[model samples]
Target: MITVLIRLLTLRAENVIPEVIWALMAIYVLAVLVTLTSVWVTFKKLEGRLLWSLIVLLVPFLGVIAHCLYCLTHADVDVLKQFGFFTRKTA
Candidate 1:
């Protein structure tokens, strides 16, 4: 049994399975959907929401990846500050 397992593990595949490809595609689609939903929910203004939605929809995979990186880097700062979406309060 151990020899059989070792032989199977040592074998290399020449082609990917159709089911595996479909599963991967499905997962990617799901991720895009969830990311789009999060973008809509996170940005309150209509303009900001529309801009981000267009970005994610137009660029697909790269848009989501870029957005993820942007969020990670700016986790502590006001993301919409540059766009003048929010006004600063003076004490």
Candidate 2:
């Protein structure tokens, strides 16, 4: 069993990660990063790091909407100290 594992592990790296897969993965990661950054910037300071991060990372697009709604509803955190949809116009 060890020999079989060793043989597979020794195979060429190119065969393991195809070019198209790599490109797609890079794009996906970039999108996730951008989305996460947007969430961070929009909220200014997110309370309960674990819950917010999980919501954003787990659901991607829908997570953004949910987080925005959460920001609107939750009053504990300063959701208007930075880039908020309503705060900018009133200022």
Candidate 3:
């Protein structure tokens, strides 16, 4: 089984096109997964499912940018505040 697997890998490496195509497909799948996860997490945080979904699907890079900005601006304040975090101190 090991030898057979090695032989298959060797053959695949000999053909650069197939390897390249496979790499591209893997990268595309990874990017899609990352984008979907990002959008889902952002939606969960923002509670704006429909609107954010549309924006994420239609605008490339913008979804990620929006998510990052939202996280940066609100994550520490709003989200954390819910869990008794970032409470104000009385003077």
Candidate 4:
């Protein structure tokens, strides 16, 4: 098990495509940035902000998806508006 992990970690330079590697890294950075900003802006309480920040940072893509799902189902419209997510005027 340990040997397999070490082998995976020690990837040869020849085996990787530089463009694809940079693209994936860029996507990850963008995702983390957007998710962290969303978490900070949407949650009013400090603990909520901190907890979601940690979740998104530590868990990667799945954490961003989870936070989005939670917000869609659980967040108030006013809160989302406060975060500048909703811009259309309400009747």
Give per-model TM-scores: 0.62, 0.42, 0.40, 0.63
Per residue, candidate 1 scores C-alpha lDDT tens digits across 1-91 of 4644454456546225555557668889888888888888777899988888788889969988977886666664476666665677779
Q: Kindly provide the TM-score of model 3 when superposed on the true structure, using C-alpha atoms.
A: 0.40
Better of 2 and 3 by lDDT: 3
Write model 3 residue lDDT over 1-91, tens digit each, in one string: 4654455467665445554567656776676567667667656655576667666567766765675576667665777789887898789
Q: Enumerate clash totals for all models, in the order shown.
A: 0, 0, 0, 0
Segments of candidate 4 deviating more than 4 angstroms: 1-16, 75-91
Instruction: Using lDDT, rank the candidates from best to worst.
Output: 4, 1, 3, 2
Stretches off by above 4 angstroms in model 1 are 1-14, 77-91
lDDT of 2 by residue, 1-91 (tens): 4654454467755444455456657777876676677566655455755567778798867876777677567743455555554554543
Candidate 2, superposed: residue stretches over 4 Å from native: 1-17, 48-50, 60-91
lDDT per residue as tens, model 4, 1-91:
4644444467865535555567668888998899899999899999999999999989978999999898798888888898898798789
Q: What RMSD does model 1 have?
A: 10.3
Clashing pairs in 1: none
Instruction: Write down the lDDT of every candidate, Cα atoms only.
Output: 0.74, 0.64, 0.64, 0.82
